[model samples]
Each structure stands twice: as structure tokens, then as C-alpha cells.
Target: MKASFAKFVILFTVLAVAGFSFYFLSSREEPSSLCPQARTTVSAPEKDARMKNILAPTEENIQAGKALFNSQAQPIPCSICHGFKGDSIGVIFQWIKPYARNFTCFQTMKDISDGQMFWVIRNGSHGTRMQAYKKLEDEQIWQLVLYLRSFSE
Candidate 1:
């Protein structure tokens, strides 16, 4: 009877530890990062409208972008801070900075051009919730840009 009681105690301890672990992980906020133009309206000159090299949001591009969005390169998924659907206000992503843009918002995206989007993804915003993805390959950055652009009306 003593041996059986000890086994039960051990099992209960293990279960308690696991439950606490899950709660802590779920509650913790991800490390902070920011965009360069968080408060500035320093806009770049519009690039050539005839910029023939601009890639469209093709099936391949969107799919690859999705992979990157869902990737675990960092602690939390992009969806956690950017919203599972890549737009705040529409979804949750409560950790996003107050100055951050809502990806799914048409008003937010309508004014942004492809080149502007590409630069932000490549270099990240200075003082906002964005972080530079300089390590990501060029194509991958473009893919993510394309995917984010897809949310525009």
C-alpha cells in the first residue's frame, strides 16, 4: 500500500509541473522589437510604376509566405503578435505595438506600395513592432511581402 501511494504522489507532481509549464508559456509575452518609422511619416519616393520586376502574389509566393509566417525561427509564431490571420483589431495579437499597422486593414494597406512593403519586411520598422528579417533570403522576404499584401482589398 505504501508503494502504491508513493507512485500516486509522483504522478501527481509530474502532472502539476506540466500544467504549470503550459500556463507559463502561454502567458509570457514575446521579446519586444520595433519598426524604424514607428512615429515618423518619412515616406520614400514612389518607385517606377513600370517596375517590371515586381512579383505578383502567385500561388507559390503565398504558399511560401505562409510557411515563413508559421515558421518557428523565433519563440512565438508571427501569428501570435501579428494575429493568426495577420491583422490586428480584426483578430487578437494584443502584444502588437500601439503604433503598428493592422495587416488586414484596407485603409492601412491601400497607401503602401510594393516597394515600400518590401523595404519594411527586409529592414523592419525602427520603433514599431516590426523586426528586420535581414537573415531571410530575398525571395522569402518577397514571398512574405506578397502574402501580407494579399490581405489588401
Candidate 2:
């Protein structure tokens, strides 16, 4: 009986160690498979710098923007998570775990500047559910960005 009990203890220890090792190994893979980019900043497309010329989100632009943002361009209704006006969730989560930023809040919006928002929307946030829309047309993305500006006001 004693011998049998000793064998059970050894088996249990071996199983526990194997289980933990498997968990650790699998967890090390990271959320994304792509290798890390050396640069810390987001890069721009190889197009005309005219992308910068677009400013002023007019009412007509806003209306157009709204359509662009709401459309099923990818998978989700951006406003659903960002809030109706996009003004509460914030662009970055300060303390919350994987927080979805509220887009309607203008205070945070102004801080990001147009370029940053365009990059994030186009590239999507890594380590999060945000997926880059590399396929979206430049005009469509601009329109969406214009609509997003309305949330800041």
C-alpha cells in the first residue's frame, strides 16, 4: 500500500508540471504572429501628401462621413462601441482593461490630431481587436475620419 501511494504522488507531480509547462509555452506566442516592426511610429501610404490637405468636416462632409463610418466596410459598427457622438470611451484606455474608446468626446479627439487618427483607423490597433483596413479607399477613410470629428464637438 505504501509503495502504491508513493507511485501516485510521483505521477501527480509529473502531470502537474507537464500541464503548467504546456500552458506557459502556448501563452508565449503573443496575440499577433507578425514580427515586430522596428519603428515606434505609424507610417503613411506612398501616395501624394494631399492626404494632409483634407480639413474641415462640414455638415455635408459629416453626413457623408456618417454613411462611411456606419457602412459595413469591415465587420463592426464603429459608433456602437465609440458611443453615438464618439465622446466618452477615449482614444486610449487610461486604467481600464482593453477599453473601447468613446469617440464622441471632443477633448480627447483634438489631442490626437488628424494624422494619428487616420493611422489608427487605417492600420488598426495592434494587441487589440482592431484590424487594419488596408483595403479601404483613401477617400472612404477620409470621409470616415471627417465623420469621427463630429464626436469631438
Residue 147 in candidate 1, Cα distance off native in Å: 0.6
Root-mean-square deviation per candidate: 7.7, 10.4
Error of 1 at 31 (Å): 23
lDDT per residue (tens digit) for residues 105-146 in model 1: 665576677667667666667776667666777677677777
lDDT of 2 by residue, 15-113 (tens): 999998886565442212212212233344535222462746667767877876665566765654553445323223232234454554444444555
Q: What is the TM-score of each candidate against the true structure?
A: 0.60, 0.55
Q: How accurate is candidate 2 locally (lDDT)?
A: 0.58
TM-score of 1: 0.60
Clashes of 1: 8
Residue 112 deviation, candidate 2, in Å?
Answer: 0.4
Shift in Å, residue 151, candidate 1: 1.5
